[model samples]
Target: MLHLHILSWILAIILFFAAYQNFSDRQGPSQYFKPLHMVLRVFLLLTLISGGVVFFQTMGGGMAAQYGIKFLLGLITIGLMEMTLAKKKKKKPSRTFFYLVIFFALLTIGMGIWLPMGPISAMFN
Candidate 1:
């Protein structure tokens, strides 16, 4: 589950940039991007679900603080992606929204690095 969560985060980052490029070109999301967008949405859902399961399953192991922060970052990352999609759907896509997605995705990915390593584990581990 942790591996899947990490994979989802990486894939979402790729999809976010791919979708962003279509908007960057002022062409909006084309057929290619549309599918990518949907896949990204699904992966984000998976990431959230898996994160929740892992957090709850291990919560009382003395790493609640780190897990809590990671969980919050994961939620915020999903929110940023949702905002990006919403803006694009409403025909109001902006660079700022795309940038937010990129920023949060990176943060989420960074924070999630420790998840599989046991809560507060270092990134290099």
Candidate 2:
């Protein structure tokens, strides 16, 4: 389940970059942008659901607070990604949102890796 959650978010990140590239085309948003964006949303949904499952399963442990913080950061990262893309599509200023997405995504990823339940930590153990 954790692996699935990780995979989904990684795919979501890739799809985000792909969609962003399509949006940055010289001719403006490419035809692929809509489809890519929709798929990205689906992956994000999967990520959320899987994260929820993991969160609940990890309850009764002392790490609940860390998990909660990671979950909230993940949500913020997703929200920022959506805002950045939407603002870009609408020709609005989105540079701040874009940077926020990057920052939050990295922060969330660091939290995930630092957590005891993830593959990275498991490997080290």
Q: Pick the candidate with the highest TM-score.
A: 2
lDDT string for model 2 (19-85, tens) is 8878762467988999999999999999999999998888879999999999999999999889989
Residue 100 C-alpha lDDT in model 1: 74
Following a full C-alpha superposition, what root-mean-square deviation does model 2 have from the true structure? 1.3
Error of 1 at 98 (Å): 2.2
Against the hidden true structure, what lDDT does model 2 obtain? 0.91
Angstrom error at residue 6, model 2: 0.7
Worst 10 residues of 1 by lDDT: 115-124
Once superposed on the true structure, which residue ranges of model 1 sit more than 4 Å away at CA?
114-125
User: Ten consecutive residues with minimal summed lDDT in candidate 2?
Assistant: 19-28
lDDT tens digits by residue: candidate 1, 1-125: 76776677777777777765655336555778778788888877887888888788768778788788878977887887778777876788456877876787677667666555543564546
